[model samples]
Target: MVNDSLPPNQRRFFLTIILGGLSTALAVVAGWPLFRFLSPDTGGADVEIVEIPRASVDVGGAHFLTYRGRPVVVLQKSAGEFAAFSAVCTHLGCIVKWVSDPGEFLCPCHAGRFSTDGAVLGGPPPKPLEPIPVVLAGDLLRIG
Candidate 1:
């Protein structure tokens, strides 16, 4: 409780200090998540490789996965060949989908299309899908 004996000016000063401190604390609490999200990945471990079983991806099919919190796609182009690319659309931040019949990646947000090889096919996408490295180890696929 505020001291009843305190002068009006002093009481106002004390209240101002308390309110300022509280508002500062509240701002920090609310802003921390936004700050972290906007900040780049500093001092974070780089995702070098990700292992996935061959059986999980069918022939001529695409498999979606996450790498370091980013979306990624692994496409089995043929019986023994597999390719990987970023699932993020180049035009915008929308995720791309695998269109099996046409054998391409489609961004539902803007109708952007990308070839199975990650090349741009149609719509507003400015560039091809970003390629990721993929290697076959025994019956597993290693992606980076």
Candidate 2:
């Protein structure tokens, strides 16, 4: 018959090992999703919509707006047509600047440049700017 009672040292050692294993397993399960959530870009699957007032933006100009308090760039193509893209640079997290003279978005940190259409013309950026889907409903512009 197995002894039901053991010395204090033996009991403590077994308990510690069991607890350690449990802790490690718990960390692996919980940490994976947490790390992914905290990542800057969760791939291209997640897209959202943002709205801006028509009068608030200028034609041939890029407006820095916010949606849900997150920064975004709104580009006015004409009187009512507009396109939107995330201000975040593809190369790095640095915010991109809209230079009206060249009709391009420039990342000052690394000289990354993106055309008005969000195409990466020249720079270290691996991909073109992230285009946010847009729709104009009366005076409101929605980007997703």
**On residues 63-112, what C-alpha lDDT tens digit does candidate 1 reach at each position?**
99988668899999999889999999999789999999979899999999
In model 1, which runs have C-alpha deviations exceeding 4 angstroms? 1-45
| Per-residue alpha-carbon lDDT of candidate 2 for residues 4-85, written as tens digits (9 for 90 to 100) | 6788899899999999999999999999999988887534434456556777779988888765445679989777778888
TM-scores for all candidates?
Answer: 0.70, 0.67
- Against the correct fold, how does model 1 do in TM-score? 0.70
lDDT, candidate 2, at 84: 85
Instruction: Give model 2's TM-score versus the native structure.
Output: 0.67
Q: Candidate 2: global Cα-lDDT?
A: 0.83
Whole-model Cα lDDT of every candidate shown, in order: 0.90, 0.83
The candidate scoring highest on TM-score is 1
